[model samples]
Target: MDDSTVDRLAAELYQVSQTGKPVAHLTKRYPDITIDDAYAIQLAGRKLREADGRKGVGAKIGLTSVVMQQLFNVYEPDYGYIMDDMVVMENEPVKMSEHFVPRVEAEIAFLLKKPLEGPGISVADVLRATEGIMPCLEIIDTRYEAGTMKVEDSIADIASIGKVVLGGALTSAKEIDLRYTGLVFEKNGEIISTAAGAAVLGHPAASVAWLANKLASYGVSLRKGDLIISGSLIAACSVEAGDAVRATFDRLGSVSARFK
Candidate 1:
């Protein structure tokens, strides 16, 4: 897509975000939209938000799991920026009124202590740069109406990420094996799903490594202090007002979020 077209689409997304009214799927309207066009539109939207005062803290990776890949019909993972405004304190109530269609997923978050610049970044490099790992809940909110939202539509809508809730104590990756880490997802005090860290591209750190290399192609690097949520360990569950969600990770503690 052209610059003007990208800007127009970004503006539409911005408007929808403010009004909580989703628009039609982008891929449906723009059948020829490519991954590059989608990222360009996402970047344009990020610029618009930054101009309005939101700061980019880090990025979120999605679709690293085979289930998520099949659900989205995308063969590879996608990444999106995490704005400072998108963070909610652990145990805080997420304002459901502010989101269009929110769903929650469990993930392992990586807080980088050193910059990772890469064309060939590996999981070992990611582990070495890690500051700590925290159990997290990623709220997925898509600005497009349900149906036929391909990877293109998702990437354009910031990988459908809404908000993040971080909890648990920070622990070094060297102290534990992420691939063997287990997670239990609870909704309203009932267990809804369970998964192991290996569910995410055989290991969560591998997902972060993938993001670093992916960003390197665009001349971007994962900088020190940046937080990256390695893709979801379990499938995302829909959330509504009065709902309570928590994710308990073995060796990583737990994080919770309430919808109100």
Candidate 2:
């Protein structure tokens, strides 16, 4: 695709994301479309990047949940960038108008004290590189209308990231057996589901390792202070207005967010 072709698709994508309209994935129409091609179009829709206007602090994992795998019909997870502006304190209410068809998921977030870059990164590397871990809520909304997305289309849509909420700070990554750290998700005082730090590709840190290597392929690197959201422990729930969501980890405390 030419520069104009990429830009045109991106612009259309951004319009729908910001306006809460929907779009169909071009790949579904043209199965021959490569992920690279899809990215060109999706990045062209860079409305979120423009709105936040902050440096990319980290990345988030998508399609990691078994439920999402079933929903999206893919086994591997996709990724998106997280900006400084998207980071907010947990337990606060977010306006509903901010996202287009937004949904929520529970995750374990890690603040990296050291950088991890690699063609061959390991799980131990992720554990040693972290400053600490915390509970996080991931907000997912599409840039296009409800449509099937190719890898590149999702990437260009900035990995379909909408917003993030962080809470329940831990003293250190080593404080708990992060891989087995288990918890339940509750909404409005009812137990909705469960997830463990282990559910995230074995450990949340491993997700960071995956992010680091994945970004390196595109000439990006993980930097110090990057708040990496490993992957969802539980399923992505269809969020509605007035819903109060919280995740309570076994050893760690709880983090909550409300939609308004």
Candidate 3:
């Protein structure tokens, strides 16, 4: 797509997000669009948010699991920026009326203490960067109309990220075997899904390393104090109004949210 078209699509997506109105899939209308173009659109949307005073807090990785890859028919993971306004406190109520097609997933979040810019970042490097890790729940919402989105479309929609809730348990990464860390998601007192940190591209830290390397290609770097939410441990579950969602991690405690 041309620059003008990319800008127009980015504006349309931003408008859709603000209005809670769904739009047609960009890939469905522009089949020739490439992943690079999709990322450009994402950046455009990020620029809009920044201009509107929504600071970039961190980033979220998507499609990191084999299950998600197969479901989307994509072989690699994608990522998106996380804005300050997207952070919700644990046990807080998220107004469903403010989102479109919202869903939730359980994951781990990395709070960085040092800058990480990578062409070849390793999981060990990610852990060594210091700070701590927290169990997290990512709320995903898409501006694209359901059932018509492609990988490119998802990328342009900022990987469909909406909000995030961070758990209170903050532990050093060096203290735990994150690969074996386990998670269980519950909705209204019923166990809905279960997974382990290994589900996230083999290890949760590996996902952060991947993000560091991937962002380097776009001239971006993970900075100190940045809160990076690694890929989901389990598949996302659809959420509705009046629902209570909770995720319990074996050693990381639990985080919860109420939809209203």
Candidate 4:
């Protein structure tokens, strides 16, 4: 697709997101759209938000887990930009009505102490650059119709990121083995999912490394102080209004949010 067409599609998707209304699959309408074109649409959408004063804070890695990849029928990971306004505090009330179709997942969030730019970034390099890790809840809201979205559609939709809740605890990467870190996800006081950090691409740090390298392909770099949310450790669960969600990590403590 050409730049004008990409811009128009991006604006359409962004309008759908803002209005909490679902739209038809972009790939179905534009069968010739490539992954690169989808990413360009995503960037164009980000520019739209940036023009409205939303600053990019960091990035989020998606589909790093086999479960999610299988769910999405995709083989590789994808990423999306994180805007500052998308963040919510732990235990804050989230307005569920603001989303079209929102789901929640448990994750480990990394706060960078040094910039990471990679063509050859490794797990060790990610650890060395780390500031700390915190438990987080990623709320994913899709703007596309159900079962109609392809990988390219997801990339264009900014990985369906809606909101993020960061936990209060921040533990150094060297202090614990992230691969072995366990998480118990609870909704309305009952356990709904449980997983280990290794569920995210063998190790949460590995996901960050993957993201750094992936972003490099687009001429982007992970900057210092970026809050990177590694792929979810557990499968995402559907959420509704009046629901209370929580995720307890073995070492990183817990994070919670209430939807209303």
The TM-scores, one per candidate, come to 0.97, 0.87, 0.97, 0.96
Model 3 TM-score, all chains together: 0.97
| Residue 81 error, candidate 2, Å | 0.3
Candidate 3 off by > 4 Å: none
Please report, in order, the local distance difference test score of every candidate based on alpha carbons. 0.93, 0.76, 0.91, 0.91
Better of 1 and 4 by TM-score: 1
Q: Decide which is better by lDDT, 1 or 4.
A: 1
lDDT of 2 by residue, 161-229 (tens): 888988857657776888788889998889999867778777777777777777777776788888888
| Residue range 1-260, candidate 3, lDDT tens digits | 78999899999999986687889999888989999999999999999999999999999999998878888898889999999999998867898877988999999999999999998999999999959999898999888777767889999999989899899888888889998998889999999998889999999999999999989988988999999999999878998999998999988889999999
Candidate 3: count of backbone clashes, pairs at least 3 residues apart or interchain: 0
- Model 2 is weakest, by summed lDDT over 10 consecutive residues, at 39-48
Per-residue lDDT of 233 in model 1: 90
Task: Compare the candidates by lDDT and give the number of the best one.
Answer: 1
Candidate 1 collision pairs? none
lDDT of 4 at 44: 99
Report how far residue 258 has shifted in candidate 3, in Å: 0.7
Query: lDDT, candidate 1, residue 42?
Result: 95
Off by over 4 Å in 4: 71-73
Alpha-carbon deviation at 136 in model 4, angstroms = 0.4
What lDDT is reached at residue 255 by model 3? 91
* Higher-scoring candidate on TM-score, 2 or 4: 4
